[model samples]
Target: MKEELIAYIKSELIGDDTMEMNSEDDLLTSGLIDSLAIMRFIGHIEATHEIKVAPQDMVIENFINVDAIADYIQRTKNS
Candidate 1:
């Protein structure tokens, strides 16, 4: 799931196949995703993961990096 999420983010959202990013790379601060992109990704994440992302769950800490997003998904799934 982590790998697939990263691939989707890189190929679809970021649209840069050559862009190398680590699991801990900062997507927001690094300008990999903006407000509009994050909104779109919220939809993608919810749909793809079958998880609900509440309005309050939308935060930089949750979506900062692939690892963070994956962790958020796991936590949300458990909740």
Candidate 2:
């Protein structure tokens, strides 16, 4: 799932080299992604995971790191 997330993020959102992603790393502060990328990521997550991301859940602090995104996915799935 981690690999899939990284691949989707890189391929769809960034369209750059996928080899640069680190599973445990944060893509936000690294400048590998930006604010706009967050929206794309959210959309991709919702579509791929078949879960809806509420508007209130769209916060930078909640989606800054890969772990956060994973947590969000878990929450959405469980809910």
Candidate 3:
């Protein structure tokens, strides 16, 4: 899930397939991605994982980085 998120962010969101990113990287605070990008990313996650992301679930803690997003997806799925 982490790899897929990274790949999607690099290829689709940033339009730079070769860009390098780590699971622990600060995607929000580091200016790697902005608010609009985050929304699109959430849409991608919802569609790809088939899990509905409630508005309340769209928190910074769940989207700080790839690792957090992956964990969020897992938790949402298990629930």
- Per-residue lDDT, model 1, residue 36, is 93
User: Pick by TM-score: which candidate is best?
Assistant: 3
* Backbone-clash count (model 2): 0
Worst 10 residues of 1 by lDDT: 25-34
Candidate lDDT (C-alpha), each: 0.88, 0.79, 0.91
lDDT of 2 at 29: 77
TM-score, model 2 to reference = 0.79
User: For each candidate, C-alpha RMSD in Å?
Assistant: 0.9, 1.8, 0.7
Model 1 residue 39 CA deviation in Å: 0.8
- Tens digits of per-residue lDDT, candidate 3, 31-78, equal 878889888988999999999999999889999989999999999999
Q: What's the C-alpha lDDT at position 71 in model 2?
A: 79
lDDT of 3 at 5: 90
Candidate 2 segments exceeding 4 Å error: none
TM-score of every candidate: 0.93, 0.79, 0.95
Clashing residue pairs found in predicted model 3: none
Query: Model 1, range 31-69, lDDT digits (tens) per residue?
Result: 778789888888999999999999998887998899999
Candidate 1 regions exceeding 4 Å error are: none
Q: Lowest lDDT 10-mer window, candidate 2?
A: 17-26
Clash count, one per candidate: 0, 0, 0
Which is better, 1 or 3, measured by TM-score? 3
